[model samples]
Target: MIYFDNAATTKISENVLEEMMPYLKENYGNASSIYSLGQKSRAAIENSRIKIAEILKIKPSEIYFTSSGSESDNWAIKDILNKKEKNHIISSRIEHPAVLNSLKYVESKGIDVTLLSVDEFGNVNLDELKNSINDKTGLISIMFANNEIGTVEPVYEISKIARENNILFHTDAVQAIGNVKFNLKDLDVDMMSISGHKLGAPKGIGILYIKDGTEINSFIHGGSQERDRRASTENVASIVGIARAISDASENIDENIEYTKDLRDYFLEKLLNVDGIILNGPIENRLPGNINISLKGVKPQTMVRYLDMFDICVSQGSACAAGSIEPSYVLSAIGRSEELALSMIRISLNHNNTKEECDFVFDKILRGMKKFKK
Candidate 1:
């Protein structure tokens, strides 16, 4: 199958699974135990933490593991409000459901939330963000990159604004880790979230990076795991897999960017030449591998299912919310008509995708769109 729905999830690399094998088998000791075998598990978890921290140039103590990026987002956003006296929060309209729902929960409790609008290119209006900040604004939570359109945000500059105002800044970098090159050492953002599955690790593991001195209350209130920040027995195997995935993705980040970008450009070049196709997001400032388009008369679900018959997998934005009838909020936020939004499909690539796969998809797309027109 020519899988192109990477933004939804990825196949775990063989090396990552191999790294986790021992943990799943003989090394299946409790990470919290005092026995030598347990200590071995603990050591492995810490080592993974250190490796991931080093990749982002952050302290190991700052990286806290959670079940998923959604959990991490809930923890960071809610914890900031919990620890602060302010009742106001700021975020963009294009955030994932994790952030949007978390904000909604808080709003129900009387906290005011200001959602900044994005321009036609799916970029957050910076001036609106600056103007919305007041003494009561406790935090500004924005995504480092959009999941659907793959529009990279001005996180560094936004972090600077947050820093100047003494407000916490958090970014959901789940999709940005391997897609773009960024160093936490150079960025002044106070918090960020990442998921292992997005980087070729297995599911059920992710990291929440809270910079030193950033006040955050605990999310899960049970065990003292994750430095008392999160609770639950650690997934030892998945944690090991995360280390391998991070190392591999970080090392080849530059090469992957060039390869995926080339494939993406080639795919788009062929796709744009088709009749009655609308490109979504900023053509110039978009993600390296993300290509979102609207097939004017074709419903996204219908078209993707058609492609699925040909073993060409694609998506309609977040996999978490894929089956819903509602149009993509990311597209709607950027002022797309409902007809276009319902017809939009996200074609996301990865390092493993190839030019041949791109050509095959292009040919299938031409056929599919022609059939739809007929």
Candidate 2:
């Protein structure tokens, strides 16, 4: 299959799998134990933490591994709200469900939340963000890059504003981790969440970076792992795999960017020539790998199934919320009609995608559109 769903998850690289094998087999010791086997596992986890920290330009102590990006996001949001009463949060309308759902739960707890508006291009307004902060504003959670539309937010500026107001800033960087260059120290963000599966690592492992000395309550309670921030035995194998993926991806990010951009641009150019197609998100300032297109008079689900017949894999929206026919709240938030939102299909690329694959997808989609039209 020609997979075009890199935004949802990437195939695990062979190198990462090789790096993880020893831990998954012979070195399968509990990191919390004091025996030599346990020490070996513990040392591996620490080494992975250091590797991830080095990639983000932060101290190793600042990184906390979690089960997934959703878990990390929930921890960051709830931890801050639990620290005090009368909490308020500010987030954009286009964030992943992980952040949005976590905020919804926080709101259910009587905490005030302002779902910030985005412009037509799916970018948060810095002025609105500045206006949203107040004495009770405990946290500001925004995504670094949109998963569906691929619009990159002004995170550095937003974090700076949060710093000026002494409000904690957290970004769900699951989509941005491998696609963009991130420096935790330079961004000044208090917390950031990243998932391994979004890169080339295995699933069920993620990282949450909390800036040094940031006070937040723990969501899990039991063993004293992750420096008392999270209480769970470490997934030693996945941690090592995640580190290897990050290191490998970072080493050649520029090359990947060029390749994916070329593929996206070529595909979009072909699709734009088709009749009654509308492109979503900013034309320029968007993720290099993302191409979200809305076809008139066609359901996205129908198009996805049609493409699947040709062994072309894409997505109608976020994989987390897939199989739900609900009109995407994200597209609606950007002022798209329910029909337009229903017609939206997202095609994301990666380094493994090729020009030939793009050409094949274009031909199949064009033929599929013609068939539907007839």
Worst 10 contiguous positions by lDDT, candidate 2: 77-86
For residues 1-374, write the lDDT of model 2, one tens digit per residue. 99999999999999999999999999999999999999999999999989988887899999999999999999999875665753999999899999888888888888899999999889999998988888999899999999999999999999889889988899999999889876887888999999999989999999888898888878899989998879988899999999999999899899998888888898889899999789988888888899988887887888899999988999998898888888888898888888888888899999999989999999988877777742
Tens-place lDDT digits, model 1, residues 185-276: 99978889899999899988988899999888888889999888788999999999988998998899999999999889988998998887
What is each predicted model's overall lDDT from 0 to 1? 0.90, 0.90
Candidate 2 lDDT (Cα, 0 to 1): 0.90
Which regions of candidate 2 deviate over 4 angstroms? none
Which pairs clash (backbone N, Cα, C closer than 3 Å) in model 2? none
* Number of colliding residue pairs in each model: 0, 0
